[model samples]
Target: MRVRIKGDVLCTLLLVISLSTLLYSLLRPTAKQDIAPVKNTKRLKNPPRTAASKKYYDSKVTGKVKLLSEDHHADVDSEDVKPTVPPVKTQSPFDFQQYLSSKDHRNFSLLINQPNKCTKPSGESFLLIAVKSIVEDFDRRESVRKTWGKEGLVNGVRVRRVFLLGIPKNKTTVSLWESLMQQESHYYKDILLWDFLDTFFNLTLKEIHFLSWAEMFCNDVKFIFKGDADVFVNVENLIHFLQNQNASEDLFVGDIINHAKPIRSKKSKYYIPETMYGLGIYPAYAGGGGFLMSGVTMTKLAEACKEVELFPIDDVFLGMCLQRINLKPVLHEGFKTFGITRPSAAPHLQTFDPCFYKDLMVVHSLKAAEIWLMWNLLHSQQPPCSQKQRIKKPFHWKKKKTKQAINAVTRLQVN
Candidate 1:
């Protein structure tokens, strides 16, 4: 009985211990706690704070923002920014108002009345005397045409119309042309006009007047004598010289300078900028001191003037026009252009002294009175006006035979 009780107690004790352990486990688990997942430890290993990762991020951001270049990504501070160029404006095709409003039209009537002030006359006519001024050193024309005009021959070719050119500043007086017109009208054919100022000729205001006359009276005239007033032209000789040459449509004349810059001096009356004209060299006949283009050339030049902007200097402007047409200037030595200082002694002198009237065809820069005197000197035996003043002597009667002899002598002298 004692052994049985001891075994039972041991069994009871084992049961109680098992029960207590079970109850403790069940009660404790009733208060539940949740646990989160473990973070990526590999991400921490390659930290975003590192320089390589930061640079990669920056590059990726830049690539993604490229489309925002217009607003934010443009290089505004760059020195190589292209400049904005303005479009070129074309001129109106035909602006008559512009013609009337141009600086040239300011004194049209005044200029017409004073043509010789800036221009010269063309061929001599029954009622007109052509005139010009030939400035050789400044003009750069040949000195051989003086003889050609007088000898009535040029390079085995004869030309019609007188092409007188070049007159220095001193030779041009205000009323000289009018005075010449009035005095020589009896002998000429018609006075076609030309001048340095003929914007076509690149002349001054006074010279333009001369050139305008040709344009003005082109309808009323035929043929031209574009010569210098300063020159001593033998009208008869010039008429004879040009009679044989065939009338040519392309009578491009003068000692043509190939390329020349139109002058643009601020102080000068003639000023032109490069933007105004595109051509660098004159393609047309230049050196107006003594050149002869056809009346058609004048027409073409006038037409071209409408299309081309006026260059302050005339010859170069004309050359530009001629170049456009692909025509060239024909160099003629017979169109005596400039200086022959000692023409009397020099070979092929284009200009000579008034005293050398017999040999001189065109002596540029002469006075009206001097021209008249020289003409008289060439054609007549005595001077027109005595250089010295002589007091009149009291008249005295002489014997009839002696008077008759004196009268005969006086008549011979007068004739």
Candidate 2:
């Protein structure tokens, strides 16, 4: 009976312990169980940040916002920004308005001059050959010097030479051109350079200035032959022509153009606007190609030129000066200032015949080679004009020239 009672007690204690364990497992709070999910939710809502990653995210957001404002946006601080549009330019091919606007800008200084040019170191200059020239026409000037314009005794009379010039129109090679002129002047002593830009319209200035120079200094000079560089002058023929004429008498002679009007076409290089000149007909003027005037007449021209208004066309301006002094210019047939015309009846005849040039005083628009060839042909005693010859055609042979410029400067004594 005692053993049974102890067994019951042990079974009851084991039962009580099992029931308490089951109750504890069923009644515990759920708060501690929800902790893992709460932490995961907080982590998903926000990611970890670094400097590079934050910059990348902000750049993406700003790109979307800036798309609407792109055209209106201008960064004032950025030097790279500039207007791509170019400035408006004039519509006309030539700026005639600007040229007309600056017409009063005349009276330029003499940059280079020859004060002692008329001193007549050789002899009282019986005839003065004044050629209008520009800087790049070195070959033309040399050809003139080598041929008719050579300063020395021609027909036993003193013949002096000079060139009228101005600053080169080509500005790019101005320095080189200027340097060459110094050497040329030192050697030739024939250049008359002025500060005015060398141009067709400014030839009037050259005309007046030369007349002033001659009037001031060349009172003793008997005759003057003024012409273009391109013209081939028969100086001997000219001297022979002057021998019979008196220097004291007024004599201005050339191929005179009777009735001419200013060219109104702006496209033409000789354009003259109505604002510049209003006259319907230009005054009767000698061709600028070549002309001969006595020293006395030249002096009168110098005085008359100062009294008249400046005109763009040099030849016409000279006519105005002549008119101012109540003087008339005569026409000379020997001066072929315009290019030669082949006889209409004899169409086959070549205009380059050497015989034709023998009697002419001045022939305009001949090449340097033609001048040289004609000079040689005439001096060599070629046949008369009536005979047709093989040399009648233009001389198309290789132009004879030295590899370097012929140093004629060395041959002539330094004046």
Candidate 3:
């Protein structure tokens, strides 16, 4: 009975011990569970201490959030953090040198040429005057044709006049201009048309092309006068000047400028950058407004043009050509490129005088009205004004009237 009682006590003791151990385990918390809640609460209460810390926190949290919210806005803040894009590059408009130096532009084919316009096998033509004109300048062309450009004899030398023209810019205008040119050619047989653009910069092209034409057709011509359409040429005085010159000697005559510098200002219409010409001083060359060259000099200049690179400025480029051939231009006092400055006298007091322009070979910048008036005045047989003060009066005369008077005088003398 005592042994059975002891066994019951032992079993009771073992059951109490097992129950205590089970209670302890149920009351104690695990390490991960205890720290997880504390960490989340701390993060919610305190902001990040620095940009680096904030970035780290945002990277960790936003990575998961981005993946979950991709359908709605994955890249909402991404653009703000992205790097800036670079700007596009642009081309320069003043790079004319590169355009000029291009190999494709080295040679140009003639669009229109008059091979037989000035040709004379027996060499009867004493002077061949080439007037650089545009296709659309019909009024100016007509004025020239009627005034100084009339085809006839000047001082007993047979003179021929031809107008130089180039292609128009507009395609529609091209056909119209071409048709008109064809009719003009048929009627006057004086228009020399070419295929290049007739621009201020392309005046050198006109010069070179005319030189080529002269070589082909007018080889035997004694003198060649290259002038602008607006100029008044005294063919009589020009012939008289040529009469004194040796026909075999090369002659290049005009109002010459020496040591002319290339215009560097970008704002100027005559701007020429160093890329076109690098020289500090330009050799002497005649103003392009009007110039005179003998047949031999024209041949030499034409040959020189072939070897020298083309310059945009016609006068400067001609100077370069002359430099290449070791030739120089003769300066004439009477070749007025700038229009004759009017004296400070009353218009009524200023009577038109024919003697004033009788000695001048070329007078530039004349209008059609002035040219006509001058032509009429020169033809009229009025006695010379005997005003003693007239000799002392500033030699001021209207351009058109002066040209007309000079041309009329030329006609009278030649007849």
Candidate 4:
């Protein structure tokens, strides 16, 4: 009986112990159940930016592309595109198209040829006279042909003559010009026509083409006298002048302009735009009215012209060619290419004094009739003047012009 009682008490003790252990386990803290406040790691590759960072990023990147996955992370404008800059354009005052056209098309087709001009021919001419003429200037050409340009022996020396021309630029009369020119060519046998527009600026074409023609045909000519149709040439005086000089050596003589600046006025006939010629002063060049060059000098000019570029002014272009070959063109008092300025001191002097002209080689700006009249008067000689008064002395500034020309040439060479 006492044993049973002790068992019951033990059973009660076991139940109590089991119930206590259960309560203790239910109330105890676990590792997963530990809830406490802590800091976030924030280790993202492209982390969220603050207000200062967002402003800085938007201003710096011009074309920032965001991926679709970044929609949840950051904010930016969809209009964030690259800005473009407009180009700056400058307008030039000069006509570039016309200039390029002239520069590109220099070599023109030949319309008429005087192949036998130097052969058959004055074979080897003592003087090859080339007059710059036009189709409409029939009277002028006739005057030149009758007077100083007469072919054959002059002063016992052979001379040949040719008139350089280009197609008439007047569209209204272009058709009629062809037939008239052909007739003139057949009659005179002295027309050297090229298929270029006969304009003032295109005179450069006449210059280079004539040089090439001279080289091909009149290779043996002793001398060449190039002049305008209006100028009066004393053939006898010219022949006398050439007799003293050797044609084998270089000789170029005319009324040379020294230290001349380009005329920039648009209305002037000799206007030179800054785009055409940028230089301040032009090279020394002979007057286009008349000039004399030796056959050897012509050959040299042809070669030099091939190397140097064509300039608008024919006279200046030739001067550039001479500069290319280091050749010097001498200025002479006998050639009054600018026309005879009546002496301010001697207003009594006649403009057409045959006695005074006897000492001169060339005189410019004479009318067609004046040239004819001068030729007859000089040959017949009715007017009389003292030998001292008739003398064509050099101007006082002649030496000064020569020195300035030399200095200008030196400056060009240095440049």
Record all residue pairs in model 2 with backbone atoms less than 3 Å apart, i.e. clashing: none
For residue 345, give model 3's deviation from the true position in Å: 11
Write down the lDDT that model 1 would get.
Answer: 0.44
Winner by lDDT between candidate 4 and candidate 3: 4
Q: What are the models' TM-scores?
A: 0.40, 0.69, 0.67, 0.69
Task: Put down candidate 1 lDDT per residue, 1-415, tens digits, no spaces.
Answer: 9999999999999999999999989877554322111122333345435454445446532112222234332644332122211333433322334433564542233311333311233332211223443332212122222222232223333233322232234555434654454343223322233333333223433334444555664423323545554555565554454454444454555555655555545333434445554555445455655455555555555555555555445556566667665668776544445534543434543332333345433445554555555665656654322332421332234435778888999999999
Candidate 2 local lDDT, 122-230, one digit each (tens): 4678999999999889999999999989998888999888899998888686568888888898889898888887888889989988888888767779999999998
lDDT (Cα, tens digit) per residue for candidate 4, span 249-346: 99999999988999886545677778778999988899999999999999999888888877778999998998888888999999999898887656
The true-versus-predicted C-alpha distance at residue 147 of model 1, in Å, is: 18
Which stretches of model 4 miss by more than 4 angstroms? 1-96, 381-415
Model 3 stretches with alpha carbons more than 4 Å out: 1-98, 101-107, 120-123, 171-175, 342-353, 383-415
lDDT of 2 at 362: 89
Total colliding residue pairs, candidate 1 = 59
Output the TM-score of candidate 3.
0.67
Q: How far is 6's C-alpha from truth in model 2 (Å)? A: 94
Looking at model 3, the pairs that clash are 370-400, 370-401, 371-400, 374-401, 374-404, 374-405, 375-404
lDDT (tens digit, per residue) of candidate 3 on 206-296 = 8888888788778888889998888877777888889999878989999999988887876456777776678888888888889988899
